[model samples]
Target: MNTFPIIETERLILREATCKDADDMYSYLSDKEVVKHMGLEPYQTSTDVLEEINWYQSIRKEGTGIRWGITLKGKDVVIGSCGFLNMQPRHYRTEIGFELSKLYWGKGIAKEALNAVMSYGYKHFELERIEALIEPLNSASQRLVEKQGFTKEGILRHYEYTCGKFDDLYMYSMLKAEFELG
Candidate 1:
């Protein structure tokens, strides 16, 4: 099993998810506004969040992905989540995803969490690239990825089936070399 040690930044901590985080996870993920731009459906209840936690736990056991709960430096509350999804070890790449509580938006927590994960992917997992598939309308996310040194690769037309329809997505990527230089 892949054991993810807690990663700390100037104002946040990225750590492995646990069942104990179900309520906190639900508090953010279940909010429609928080997940509106994310492709996944808004969680309906705490049990829904628990199921996600269970799924992440299983993935961790298989050493296929790393999922983290985002918490502030002096707080135990989980304000968001960031992780590698659709990890392709043979390809040396993985899709990155994140969600934060609406209240935490604009606080730069997402960027901090993302940087920590990208560093982990490069230095520890030996990943060559990290990618994010984002909705074109999500300018906030686009700016975040750009600030982290991801470049616009291309647009995948009608790429993801989300929110009851096919949505076009912008593909953003950061290479290990690109991240190292920035």
Candidate 2:
């Protein structure tokens, strides 16, 4: 499967991530506030970001997951990363995750990137469902998925361990038909 696709939105570009993007990606991944709810510690250095990009590339090669760097239309730096996770063609489903720089928060950049990704999943990948797992306290992520037409199914208790404790997550999903209605 062609896992890495360059998707463009009016204000954003979702392109395959690479080691060259380490510096730009590290700018956000190193911020505690940006990764607080994403179950990852702030990266201590750009080398960590480089390793992460390599891992992302490997997974895309294996057809398991695909992560994209989110860049502004006119900018050359990545402001964030977003993509499909645990892609299961047999089940026609995949989970989505995203993280944006705190500097770009509240600008709707995430929504723009996610919408493009989900549209690709439904149209090109023939996905029947797209899911999101949001920490209970991460209202912003919940709102992002909700705004994209995903319905909250329920909460998964102790869904993930992050920041030294087990965190509950709200499960949300949007079906292909639901996305088409929008």
- Give per-model TM-scores: 0.94, 0.95
* Distance from true location, Cα of 153 in model 2, Å: 0.4
Q: What are the runs in model 1 whose C-alpha is more than 4 Å off?
A: none
Per-residue CA lDDT of candidate 2, range 48-156, in tens?
9987898788778777778889999989899998898889989999999899999999988998989898898899879999999999889899888888889999999
Candidate that scores best on lDDT: 2
The predictions' CA RMSDs to the true structure, in order, are 1.4, 1.4
- Candidate 1: tens digits of C-alpha lDDT, residues 35-150: 88987788988888888888777767776677889999889988898898888889999999898899999987898899998998899889999999999999999999998999
Supply candidate 2's per-residue lDDT for 133: 94
Q: Which ten residues in a row have the lowest lDDT in candidate 2?
A: 1-10
Best by TM-score, which number?
2
